[model samples]
Target: MTTLIAEDLLLLLLDDVKGTPTSSYLDVALGGALLLELALAEAVHVRERTSVWSSAKVDVAPGAVVSDPVLADALGRVAERERAASDLVTRLGKGTRDALTARLAERGVLRREDDRVLGLFPRTRWPEADGRHEDEIRARLTAVLVQGLDPDPRTGALVALLHAVGAAPSAVDRGGVPARDVRRRAKEVAEGTWAAKAVRDAITASTAAMSAVMAATTAAAAAGS
Candidate 1:
């Protein structure tokens, strides 16, 4: 089965043994990935920012449709109305990780385990079941980030999302490369012309939005604590 870019990202976010997310912001990253997928299908577009202070907004194309149920649902939500990319990131991303995880589990790429934490809370975990596919994704990331190869659009978008979520550095083996250099390279690729100009704009907007929300949430949690 062909997996979505979002699926590839989830695989990276998940711990192979722990079956839990390494980052707390999985939804934001997955949401950005979904937006990228919609952009690739021409199902959605990001309105240009009128000013530097303005946020990019995402809107659905007229009559846009996708075959995948997950993408289709997200497209329908986008079709409801134009929204700031940041707002859409959280809105579209709500509960999406679970849906994607279930899909991955169905495909046998992950194994679902249900457990109770101290017999008080219910939880689910998705550990690696068939790692071959994930291995391929890691190889692609290594090629682009470490081997200095240019990325195809899909791989490039995946890198951009991983970088956006601050997970790029840990997603693959650095092969003795310095962490800072790896980060710099990932940033360069995220800003590269691997994708169309419009798509690039969407990616930039989506990632910026995700970052803004993540930061705000972090601050809010800190304040609450």
Candidate 2:
């Protein structure tokens, strides 16, 4: 089965050697990726806000059949009621990492490693089992973000998600390109006039929501520390 964009994003954020995620805001990014995938699949529609004060509204596309269980579950949740795209990011993304990671492990793209931190706290890690697929994904990202090539919808959507999570600069090797230049390029692609207005609005809402979630998480962690 073809991997979802969310899966790809998770793979990118995960450290291949340590089998741990590089980003703290992974769930938010994963949720945003699912929304974007649903948008691309036409399984859901994100209506543009009618006014500046209104949020982008999300609605399930009637009779949309999502073959993947992960997406199907998200589509079902979306069908429950219309919601602001921003609100659904967290709602739909909740508890998705386990499912996605398990799927990747099942597919042999990753290996499940059960261990303990300091031999005291139990923890699980997913180290790279097969890297060919991730290498291909990185190649595509490099082509667009650093090589200045036009991106297809999937690639464009991936870039937008990476940008949302503030990972675009680190997602790929910059080679000769400056990190700022890569970031600027990602921002341009993310905000460019390539996708439909609805898709664009969804991305914008997801980005805002992702940022908010990340901020809250960071603050909470600091407070706890």
Residue-pair clashes per candidate, as listed? Answer: 0, 0
Best by TM-score: 1
Candidate 1: pairs in clash: none
Q: What is candidate 2's lDDT per residue for 96-175, written digit by digit as tens?
A: 99999999999999999999999999999999999999999999999999999998888999999998778898888799
Residues 1-225, model 1: lDDT tens digits: 698998999999999988999989998888888998999888898999999898888888888879999999888888887789888888878889999999899889999999999999999999999999999999999999988899999999998998888888787789899877778889999999889987998899889988999999999999999
True-vs-predicted CA distance for residue 150, candidate 1, Å: 0.4
Q: After superposition, which runs of candidate 1 have C-alpha atoms over 4 Å from their true positions?
A: none
lDDT of 1 at 126: 91
- Please, what is the whole-model Cα lDDT of each candidate in the order they appear? 0.90, 0.89
